[model samples]
Target: MTPTETTTDHPPRAGAKEWIALAVLSLPAMLVMMDLTVLHLAVPHLSAELAPTSSQLLWITDIYGFLIAGFLITMGSLGDRIGRRRLLLAGAAAFGVASVLAAYATSAEMLIAARALMGIAGATLMPSTLSLIRNMFHDDRQRTTAISLWMMSFMVGGSVGPLVGGALLEVFWWGSVFLVGVPVMLLLLVVGPLLLPEYRDPRSGRLDLASALLLLAAVLPVIYGIKKLASDGFGWLLIASVVIGAVFAVLFVRRQRSLDDPLIDMELFRNRAFGATLGIMTAATFAMMGLNLFVMQYLQLVHGLSPFRAGLWVLPMTGAMMVGMVLVPVLVTRIRPGYLIAAGMAVSAAGIAVITQVGGSGGFDLLITGTCIMAVGFTPAAALGTDLVISAAPPERAGAASAVSETSNEFGGALGLAILGSVGTAVYRAAMDTDLPTQLAPEAAGVARDTLAGAVAVAGELPAGAGATLIQLARAAFTDGLQATAAVSAIIALAGAVLAAVLLRRVRAGEDVEPNSDDTAAGQVTPNVVAT
Candidate 1:
């Protein structure tokens, strides 16, 4: 069918029932992000209770993300074959059960196992929610609005996670953090079937086991390596892990091309709108995540603000992001998404440039202003970029397409943390090595060089004047690292802006662009456009 015909015969607009179902769908989406953020706050409490060894503690923290990244593609494809609602409900049930297991776990190993299960279950939720949004909100404008709201929920979840976790830890055990998801999931289980519509591709082929395995092999090692690199710095084992994942990824792609019915539709990437939008989203996420790492640490370690106070200071940025997300649907009606997205990236680059001027002793005003600007600037690409990704795919393959979008985000965040973090760490170490107090013992000096946290701890053990001097030098070195990282991020944001402008210039607002005749000849579904 032609693009015109597709628009002419577009699916009926969603009703109040569909809108209510969106609220129901959003519960799990918020809960999934909450799970990611809340765990970090609980780490100290859980460690005291579980008394886990160093490796076990690492597993407890890292395994959840690792498993989620590994299973996302598989779960997304599974949802396409089974039913999105069905998969969503099943995942909710498993997530709830895992939460319970994690909450009452008797040992470190058990908690790790529970978290791993939660990861796999969590993977099922993200793509299912997005794909369902695609299937439910058939109207272009409605879909964009729904996606914006959906993205907003994630920001809400992430922003409140620390506050909620901190509040719970004050009066309750560490396990209380895990219990937060139980009520949310239980609500999803009860109302989800009654409210949410079921969607699946009737023509989808059976799930390919080998491809699933290959995806796992490809994603797990790379994510693991990235996490290791961020935490432990560069190492031969980590490099090998990344190389192994690359090999498996190549094999996975080749196998997909040969299959009559591949696990994911590779041709979707051939659509320039889809491909370019995905790239922009990933790059934007990379810059945002990398800078966030330094900003948080700077608030606590350099400025010596309490965690709660630091979190309160961050509210403005979150508010700025929420405002931007709310406005994009309205703006997209008047502006070409390509230009709008490019402008957003350009603004983000400008914000990162502001961050580059932040100093060691005091720059609280600049830090908040820059991050809020960055948040506002980045929101357009995140909201509209996601809409384009799903809209550009055939509805039947929306699940797989959503998975690919999310997977790119995971890779982007990990790469940002790893590469930028390594650069910052190297810079800090180099500066600290030359600036350390000569009277300090070698072991103490080495500890101070390792991290800002270490420097703080070691400084406390020194004479009062020396301690103050050491802290001053450490903060200065860390600030240098932050400045360097921000510079790199600014460059990346600008590059993304240029790429979006060049690649997506033809993607006008309020109109759908279909795949060319070549895509039709290749048996690819025509890409849908969001109407004004």
Candidate 2:
């Protein structure tokens, strides 16, 4: 089929300018996703400057994602009603303003609020860039190539975020890192109007207020619960959060079924390609997020590296991702995507297996070797999974579908941290039992563990023998926990690869082709595939 024969939701004649618009819109995605990991590197500085309470520090890093998870569907659907280009610009402006709020904040609470607002704004950018790219690219080869680069920029941001944040922290304060997004947003805002075409769903209905509320009600508590699990462990609060999230989730699904224009088209799951691809993406994200969190902590605390040095050590992973992004587009022409994902997963499993052996005694060399191998092994799956999500959805529903993809990304990260983090904490506490100063009041250990500095301080006040024993226990416990987590993640990655091969076996090359929207102008119509 010709380019014009497959174009949908826009003029069939998109050129290089349209591609530029797609790339520029992706900038905000990079900024938003980058912020997710960048804050870990900045935590030490933020704590020193703001003296945020333990809960407040977690909020500072997590609120952006929390709000994004809560509002993604509503905002994505809204973009389909209003012009996507309009919403992208509006979201960019909001993001810029939020960045300003975050940068100038005098208190931790203020910064947390700003990040939440930025999440709401950031949600708008992700779906718009992806759906817009689907609108712009018609030829299968060109679309594959475009989606590859688009996925690259977003993943690259994630990989490079800690490095960039660390570099900025070396010279400037923690707040300065928030300002890094400003220039990129400006470039998007400036170029968006000149090159991007406007698009909206003419048939979109009124925003369903009840469904939106139910969505926020559902996602927020679950994410909160998971985050709590990471910090604490299994408890009443965690159980309640899970229960409440489930209740809201039930309501949200019911509302979607009854409503004329649902926030999510429930029927989209019937597409095998779309459904299985999302699963792969979600599972991949779970492994990546868990690894990133533990490795950074291990690098800084146990390895005795500065935040800047820790970030620099993550470069191999980032470099591997860029290489994978560049290579996958070319490889897709000859090999099936399912096989690509499987091969990648096998390699990733091997890499994570290596991490299982790392201990407190391991140096940066060990960290680099493990993270680099895992990154190379996993990059192909991440890049391919995203491409599949975009290619599987119809044009009109692309925004909603992309929102689902990002939600999986956000939720996977949140849950991975919660579950794996809890695992780590439990092991740490377990191994340190009596060595954990029962002598120094309960309040002291609680306060000390809350801050790295406080933890170090408490070590000083203890008796020499007790303090040395305590440090030894803490290190041993953490290493054991991390190794266990890595083993589980490797198993999960391997299982996911097997499942993907089974689910995607029928997806032949060029299955993404669709009848062009211009076919309507030419008085031809295509048959629709019914949901099974």
Candidate 3:
């Protein structure tokens, strides 16, 4: 069919019922995002009860994100062949069951197994939610709004995680954090069938078992390697895992090229808009998450706020982001998305510039102001960039397309946390070694060099005079490291903004650009497969 003919056949815009369903579908996405960070607050409690070994302690906290990131593409494609709603409902069921298992686990191994299962189920939720949004909102304008709201849900979940985890811990055991998923997933299970429309690719072939395994092989090892590098500096085994992942990734792509019905829609990337927008989203996330890691610690260790209070301070930044996300869809009706994205990213870079000036206990205003500004600026890039990615793809392949966007996001976040965090840690460790008090023992000095938290812990093991002196020194060194990291993050954001402006210049808002002109637009609208 011609582009005009295809566009004419599209479904009507969604109504109030569809809007309610969108709200309902957002629950799983929120829950999963919250699950990623909530465990940090529960670690002490969980360790005290489960008595996990040092390595097992790391696994208990990290394995969920690792598996979720690895399986996103696989689960997204699985949703396409089997059915989006069906896959979502099944995942909700599994998530609820696993949450209960995790809450009551008797041993470290049991909790790890439960968390691993939760991760697999969590993987199914994100792509299905994004793809469903793709299928639900037919008009470009309405779809942009829906996508922004969906993205905001994730931020809301993240913003609330520590507060909610802290609250639950006061009255309940460590397992209460795990149980938070149960009620949310149970609600999804009950409401999903009635509200969610089913979507699957009729032409999608049998499950590509070998390719799926290869995808897992490609993602899991590399992420594990990165995590190890972040936590333990570097090792030969960790380096080997990254190399293995690179080999498997090449094999996976070659396998996809050979298949009649490949797991991912490789042609989607042929659209310049699709490729560029994904890159922008990835880079934007990397800058934000990388810098925010240090920002979080600065609020706690440098400024001496409690963990829960630190979370409270973060609320303004995320709140500003949610506000900006809601506004971008409306703004894009008049402004070209390319320009909007470029401008927003530049503003975020400006925020990073502000962050670089932060001092040890002297620039709290600058810190909050800069970060909230960054949140406001970066929010538009995230929302509009996602709109462009979904807009660029064929409707039938929404599940796979959404997966690519989501997978890039996860990869960018992981890369940011691993790399930028390591940089800050390295600086802190070196600075602390020089700042150690003369009264400190050799083993105590070594322990204090690892982190600000370790410094505090080791100080508690010392005489009162030495302990106070060590804390003053460690906090100062950590603050210096944070400022340096902020400078690097600012550079990353600025460089990325310049790239976005150049690459996305031809793309415009409101979606009627010529499809054949690759540089001018994302893609032509196709006939809708189902009504919302």
Best by lDDT: 1
lDDT of 3 by residue, 179-295 (tens): 998888888888888888887766678879999999999999999988887788789978999999999999999998899988886766767678878888888888899899999
lDDT of 1 by residue, 1-532 (tens): 2222153446568899989988888888888888888889899999999999999999998888888889988899899889898999999999999999999999999999999999999999999999999888877778889999999888888888888888898999999999999999999999988888777776677899999999999999999899889989889979999999999999999999999878887887877778888899999989999889999999999999988787778889999999999899999898888889999999999999999999986888999999999999999899888888887778778888889888989889999999899988989999998998899899999999999999999999989999999999999999999999999999999999998888877776434345552222122243442211
lDDT of 2 at 415: 75
Candidate 1: C-alpha RMSD after superposition: 3.5
Give the distance in Å from residue 148's predicted Cα in candidate 1 to where it truly belongs: 0.4
What lDDT, from 0 to 1, does candidate 2 have?
A: 0.76
C-alpha local distance difference test of each model: 0.88, 0.76, 0.85
Question: Residue-wise lDDT of candidate 2 within 461-484, one digit each (tens)?
Answer: 888887666666566666777887
Report residue 190 deviation for candidate 2 (angstroms). 0.8
Worst 10 residues of 1 by lDDT: 517-526
Query: In model 3, how large is the Cα lDDT of residue 44?
Result: 96
Q: How close is candidate 3 to the true structure, as a TM-score?
A: 0.95
TM-score of every model versus the real structure: 0.95, 0.88, 0.95
Off by over 4 Å in 2: 1-15, 40-58, 107-109, 434-457, 462-469, 512-532
Candidate 1: where is the Cα deviation over 4 Å? 1-11, 510-532
Error of 2 at 137 (Å): 1.7
